[model samples]
Target: MNAIVTMDALTVDTGVRDLRAADHLLHTLAAELALPEDAFGCTHLVRGDRPRVALSLAFPSEPLLRTAQERLTARGYEVTPGVPDPMGRAVLYPGVSSLTGTLTIAELLSRSAIARVTVLGSPGQPAPDTELVTRDHVRPHWHDGELVLTAMPAVGGTLVPFEVPDPTPCCADH
Candidate 1:
């Protein structure tokens, strides 16, 4: 993954096959950096090798941007300082706790911009009729045999992987 930090935002471009992992990383970073929920945004990019995804967070100040850069860099990420687009979309973080419970689709959407939700083994599948979700550190897990809501991390939230124990391996070849 490639990360760019500016005075206004932190953007991450990931090439991992699993979108869940990418979203987790983005959200985790935001929480670690103490960014606000409204600062997060996510989008899928078209790529040939694997599933490419881009996640970003708008920093409220230059100090926050520098702090986030330093933190990510210390964690081995090559954070580059750049100029972010003024009109880029802002993604809001969902304030879901890391507890087990049920949430409706509307409630989830009101808190996050989760691009998609699917079953554990089924990728690209739409959410079920009930649209109920279970939260585990903002990483939506399957609730009562239903679908899992995949969302990018917002401020005050962290990412928890559902399947992959570690997602760094997928980026090694890059």
Candidate 2:
């Protein structure tokens, strides 16, 4: 799906070289900055010879953005004024805690900033009562200024997010 972004963003590059570290830093920064309720924190994979995970954040207000930039900069991070890409998997967002464990489609929407939930190749949305086993990792993307999650059907007629917490490489043991 195409992304339609009309939001202000900031990026941080502290040479974070892995997803785990990036996730930890994102949480630390969010707490240290006391980010406002509407903030979104995401990790973008920068793959190449020198692979790394880059952090991006979208703030609802200018003052909040500036404060984040200032505080992050003070901590020796390379804080820039824009994001690497529009589609970032959210790590910190409203009601993120409620997304853990099993939840109904209706419960997910009611508890979080997510505006829509879609299932892959289903031809239609899932029933509200359909359960989503979050796997303790629910990464929703920003679409048209609204948060959207895409899940896939799993065993037992339940669902799981498309992006998992731990992913295997194509030829890991080759």
Candidate 3:
């Protein structure tokens, strides 16, 4: 959300095995805890030795962090009191909901907490008038210490998020 900075972070491991479930759990926990606008909900992948998806929620202050930890602990999650290595993809952040539908590149930057939108395979940013078809799913990540969205050119010269909501299965046609 608002400029993902280096902050005291906590890891929430709910034993969710996949990204979709992890995202749901993150939203659920945030709602249950009444997370503040600046609070960040990130998803991490835990590989090997009990592979599963882990979540991280970082608040703007230590008091909020403590409160979240206490609440998550009360909910019976294995809450670790620190951030995981390679802070995972953000599933919940400030102004995330406003990114749905189609938005101009300028409107996207002005309206949402996302700091930058980088088009795939391009060294330059998309034009302000470029339409971004959000498709009801816009998930940005912390890149180079900034909250950035990666998009690719689509039909009609519009752009779409690099990661779609529903991806084709690896062997679906078989």
Question: Against the true structure, whose TM-score is highest?
Answer: 3
Q: What tens-digit string does per-residue lDDT give for candidate 2 at 1-174?
A: 322234567899889987778888988988888887678888888888878889998887778888888888998988888788777778898889778899999999999988888999887889999999999888888776678899999999999999888888669989
Arrange candidates, best TM-score first: 3, 2, 1
Model 1 lDDT-worst window of ten: 83-92
Candidate 1 ranges beyond 4 A from true positions: 1-7, 41-51, 81-174
List the global CA lDDT of all models.
Answer: 0.47, 0.84, 0.85
For residue 96, model 3's alpha carbon misses the true position, in angstroms, by 0.7
Better of 2 and 3 by lDDT: 3
What is candidate 1's local distance difference test score?
Answer: 0.47
User: Which stretches in model 2 have alpha-carbon errors above 4 Å?
Assistant: 1-7, 47-50, 168-174
Q: Which candidate number has the best lDDT? A: 3
In terms of lDDT, model 3 sits at 0.85
Model 2: lDDT equals 0.84
Clashes of each: 3, 0, 0
